[model samples]
Target: MDVQAVLKLADELVFAKTGKHLEYLEEAILRGTIQGQKYSQIAEDFHLSEGHIRDVACELWKILSDVLEENVSKANVRYILERAKFYNFSTIGNDNLTINNVNICPQTPQSPQVTQQPQETSTQPHIDLGDAPEIFRFYDRTSQLTTLENWIICDRTRLIALLGISGIGKTTLSLRLIEQIKTHFDYIIYRSLRFSPTLNATLTNLLQIFPQQADIPQNIETQISQLLNYLRQYRCLIIIDDVQMLFCSGQLAGQYKTGYEDYQLFFKLIAEVNHNSCLFINSWEKPREIAKLEVNNNYVRTLVLGSLGLAAKEILKDRKLSDEEAWETLIDTYQGNPLWLELTASTIQDLFGGSVSDFLQCDAPILDESLQAQLDQQFQRLTQQELAVMIQLAKESEPVALPDILKILQLSVSNLVNAIRSLVIRLLVEVKEEGKTTFFSLNTVMKEYVKNRYMR
Candidate 1:
């Protein structure tokens, strides 16, 4: 269902008759219609004003209508071309008409026409998932994988959270899962929020994919409604990676950047409102709205990824590291984090003659230079209160109670509450509920890194 090819043929025909090739802006506007995108979106992408874009579009449509001897506009352009027939040219000598089936000549005035011809086979599930990287290999996550599958297919979950710290295989697992369940979806779009694209930009790109809807609105609320309409109309699976980017750095968890706060209402609607489609977010931290809406329902589910166990040994075996006895200790010491293991295993192979025993004997410090650098990227975003809480947690062998932490740090109740909540949301601190009392502690990797370096 790619309209790019059809539009290219039409453009060639246009050039042959008018000596004037379609201008860059004109071409972009046409392409937007084919992809079912809105003018506001097209304008925003090209840095053109809304009024100016429409003016250009009107002129462009007039030119196309005259060139094709048919009614041509952004709305009916794709419909007309889909049903039109192409033929060899004899009208202009030496001007071969190899390209056909492009022009807006719909018969009815009631509504846009749907061609009787069946749509072409699926093309990479509607979104720009074509550039997605290969998973290479996946370890034992059969139980977790099955749970997610059931959640999407059987339980009809509209919102699913794949939450874990970096390098726990969140992205890889998503890629693998989509490949398996793509058959069930009418449109599957995968977008990365790593760059923190605005809700407007994200929706603009999204609307274009579901080309059935021609004119999306300029208003943000309208845009959300338009998306919801599509979700109800089509069984779409939208997967957004690196969703934590939407959260404001140096603030408590779930606080979005100023302009991005609309995403909270957006997520709330997606969870509470009914729609056939589902959204899967792979993030280090859950957005504030999600934390509130995450009730124990089949419709909303969250999966937290932990370390990979025995299967990680396969990595050691392939790396040709010696001493099976030391592998478990190494895995446990580092918490079997896939990325950490990959980095450390390679480092050991290069530096320690592939001897797990030698690496264990040194046991110098768990956070190597590379691993620390990775952790630093996330740690740099933490606030002063959050850092203070981490230091307090590192002092305890057992999880410390809230009152004990407040006393030890001699902090205000308000500061302690905000810091603990933020730290927990950021996945820096783990919490345990012991009857009426609550406890907090840092993970081995964080405790070791903060203690040796900052605590020193």
Candidate 2:
């Protein structure tokens, strides 16, 4: 086939299998291969990286192999082109066998006398990682982006705390924000405490990211002082993801025992002084002293991200459902979590025969015990009546106002309001204001689990 026709067919085939289009570089490589250009020549001509060109060519071969039902190689590029010509694809090559008039036969035919072969089925889809992009995908939290941006840019707010439940995209959002604002600072460092690296190891990693000619300091105190001086000398943004793993409780912020005392001191220094702008993304609440310092002192700000929004729902729309309502129901049931949405979307095509509403409304729910444990830890001190009010709101469809909650739970308004305020203080339920009225929503994933399990 002509290069244009082959490119067009490849585009259609790629979109048919994967719900995304071939990137521009992929198209250029395909056209170059059809023209019999050497990879080296193509790389130099386009001013492209040689490795990048080869990667694209490899992906193109995989796509063509799947579409043509045969192995495609650099030596057989011409053969593939002839096959395309036989399939009535337009071509400029001389080996065309009546390109426009050629009749391509089907791979299999239906006949009474013919024996048919059984089709094999597999549970997993074939994914070519070579074709995947290098960038990580962020799922949700537009409001969180704005909050982080404002804190970083505004002089009044320096240290920002990103608080959320586990697996709620805290790390992902922080990484994305850093990627966006990386150019604003001379140095940007992302350190994860998920593995609970020791103070020495953590400082070593930080040094590796931005090397200094001076020898490493011997002790944690001197090391931290030198690091702080380095950061203060240059505009830097440091992010500490999974910061909760470093601390045991909120009270003793800087009181780590034995081996971890250095880390505690590091945190204490960061909290006490304002040398560099730092962002801490964690699941648990900060230590009371740290939080108090942030609130009373104007330099630090706290931003808690909840869940995905309507825009995040659009990511699943290409999954091929029967209608928009089914899609909406699925998004609601999964709370627009990217991983959950992707997992559920893959199986949804088969579930079309089942009732979408019934599927969403089912009583069986996946117990996210970690989230439950966190909430329990936060609410263990509350009284039974207060817990009851929280449970009612957690299971409610609409945001239950104080009066409605009191009526449903058969409790006094004063008592119900107190419970609601307690929940809000603990960041269990978010109170949203709309003019004179206020509404509440449980933490995103919490709402999904509660509605699916308790309210049915």
lDDT of each: 0.74, 0.57
Question: Compared with the true structure, what per-residue lDDT tens digits does model 2 show for residues 1-456?
Answer: 466766765665454334356788877777777788877878998998776687567656644444444446655755675676556454333222122343222222121111111111222312112121243455556557755664564332446677765545676787677655554466666667767778898887675554577888767777787777766555467777766566543222222435666665575576566554454545444434455677566656777765575655566655544455755656665555555555555555455343444455555233345444544454554556655766777777677566666667877777667667655644567688877878876755566554554456
Give the poorly placed runs of model 1, Cα more than 4 Å off: 1-127, 296-298
lDDT of 2: 0.57
Number of backbone collisions per candidate, in order? 0, 2
Error of 2 at 325 (Å): 3.3
Off by over 4 Å in 2: 1-135, 139-143, 154-157, 247-265, 271-276, 318-322, 346-358, 361-427, 430-456
RMSD of each: 17.8, 21.0
Which lDDT tens digits does candidate 1 get at residues 221-257? 9888899888877778898888889987787776788
